[model samples]
Target: MAKTQKGDKALHSLFAGATAGAIEAFITYPTEFVKTRSQFGGKKEGPIAIIRETVKTKGFGGLYSGCTALVVGNSVKAGVRFLTYDYFKRKLSDSEGKLSAPRSLLAGLGAGMTEAVIAVTPSETIKTKLIDDAKRPNPQYRGLIHGTVQIVKQEGIAGIYRGLFPVMMRQGANSAVRFTTYATLKQVVQGTARPGQPLPSAITFGIGGIAGLVTVYTTMPLDVVKTRMQSLSARAQYRNSFHCAYRIFTEEGLLKFWAGTTPRLTRLVLSGGIVFTVYENIMKVIGNSGEETS
Candidate 1:
């Protein structure tokens, strides 16, 4: 019974994360498109300017240039994130016979790092290409499939993994901060609740949202470098994360590295809050069933 209940919780968590990711992708994809374009030095335009230019140049569908990759990437990313984190939480808690904050942190970090390897590389590759192709005279990829296949053929298996190191760094850091902070904050918020009362979804969502904002802002610089590195042509000059970061910093200045952060952070807040709230609620519903069955 206990094992069955655990399996149900895991399945529910995956479903919730995937649903939230899909919804958030549609809601915030334009911001993401703008952020990617700006990050790659395609346009220095603000979000509004970028949106206007994209529509003017590519039509209304322009804003969703990378929607396919975003959906697949985010779904896998969130699914792995929640599933692995939950797995770690259960294992760590059972091993110790208690849930510790550090255990949660480790779980989140491990989950993020793992997903970074499995999902982030190919996803970002497609996304970057789509965003960059938007301004090209003759676009290479008509969609995600074309783009991915082109990369595989032209650059080989290793090509799809471009900017992976920086991705791992950014995502690992982002998840480490996001999950650890969320775990700590959730406990703090729940501590003030009345005896036997559960923490509100709003509280959990709010805490997660704030953590997302902090993590994105803190890691924006690395994200910028990663985007640039990934957008480079297969024959382009730069080699490796260190070289890319150094060149961008030396040539672009410090503030340039943080370009598009405004839109990125805004998207994080709106999307993160909604996704986390929905995810927690879904988890709650599933958890209730598990409790009843137990």
Candidate 2:
């Protein structure tokens, strides 16, 4: 969706998007944690097993090991995504405020890339390392700030952006798939509705869920590689995203590329539903129908 009318200020998109992302991140964080652990490559553990093991060793709170960074990052990332999408969609849309699917895909790609570079890369590096640290006998960092400092001190600023390429690729494709799917479905669902009329929350959630489900299957390999490339050992283990994928394929077989699918699938579906529903409702309350700006 365009998320704002032509005259809407950029701050509206930022607040609404950040709120939605923070809500989704907190709600779905456990699944996210489990998903990361499962994606650690060479780990054959299923989501349930990972959860059980984490809880056994570190208690239930362990499932939220690296959540603080993600919540903050996701909030900023979501804000950047919506803001950038609104900006690009305005440029790409027709004079009648109609955006073609192709244009929507391009806009989404641009938004994803922006967010990946500005927010995701560094935050993800820290989050992944924190989760890995939790599994160690001797944890290196005390918290998010300390961990970030430690990483920067040890490896320079580049350390916190270890998987930049894969992150960009994965996020670009991910948003392209998701925004296209969601926008297309929203059009279908809103067929014949007045331009400003909003779909029911249930319908919006369903559409978002479907979008996420499709994205999960299509982008699983990229996500797997992204995870591996962001790990603390990524520099020594793999040279780049391609090398990471090659290693996973040759060492662990094709199925390994789908590692963490179940938890990720769960998280994304729920995340989609939560994010869109919250964003739309919040936008409505803020006096915007979130219509595409002409």
Candidate 3:
């Protein structure tokens, strides 16, 4: 019975997370596209300029150049993230199901690393490649499948795992900070509510946004490095993650490490809010249904 319940919980998380991820990805992809464009080596153009130029050159659809990859990737990434987080948090918690902040951070770190290795690295690599390829005079990739196939043919399986280490590090820190902040904020907001009771959607959105806001600034540098490392030109320009970071700092200055902050901030804040709002509400409905059937 205990094992059955655990399995059910993991299934619930997977379902809720995937749904949330797909919604968030669809809603915020333009910002993601703009952010990536800004991160590519060029004059520091504003996000608005990038958007206008992309639209003028390739039509509005250009802003969604890699939407399919991101949507699919985020769905799988969020599913794995929530599933592993629940599993690890359960193990780290006490007998009474209470988890401290430190343990929560550890659980999030483990979840992030698991998802980074399994989902994030390859997904991000593909997405970045597609976006970069789209900017060329004669874009090589016609669409997601062709782009993926071309990359694999040119570079083998390693093509899709180009920025594995930096992605793992960025994702590890991202979830660690995000989950911990979200949990802490939720607990604070839930003070008057009964244990295990769900908070209102608005409160979840606010907390999640705040968590994302904090995470973006804290992890922005790593994100920039990850993007640079995963770009099509990375092999020619960068030896590795550290070398990438060093070049950005020494050549481009410290602020260059935060190349796409504005767009990333916009996307992530909305992403965190939308993802948690959707996930929590879905989970609540699932829980209620389970209780009714049980």
Model 3: number of clashes?
A: 0
Per-residue lDDT over 16-93 for candidate 1, one digit per residue giving the tens place of the 0 to 100 score = 887777788778888888888887753367778888888998898998997899888988888777778778777777
On lDDT, the candidate that comes out on top is 3
lDDT of 3 by residue, 56-167 (tens): 9999999999899999999999989988888888789899887889998998899899999988998899999999989899999999899999999999999999989989
**Which rank order by TM-score, best down to worst?**
3, 2, 1
Steric clash pairs (candidate 3): none
Local error of candidate 2 at 291, Å?
Answer: 2.4
Error of 3 at 73 (Å): 0.4
lDDT of each: 0.76, 0.87, 0.88
Worst lDDT 10-window in candidate 3: 285-294
Which pairs clash in model 1?
none
Per-model TM-score versus the true fold: 0.90, 0.95, 0.96
TM-score of 2: 0.95
Model 1 lDDT, full chain set: 0.76
Error of 1 at 273 (Å): 0.8
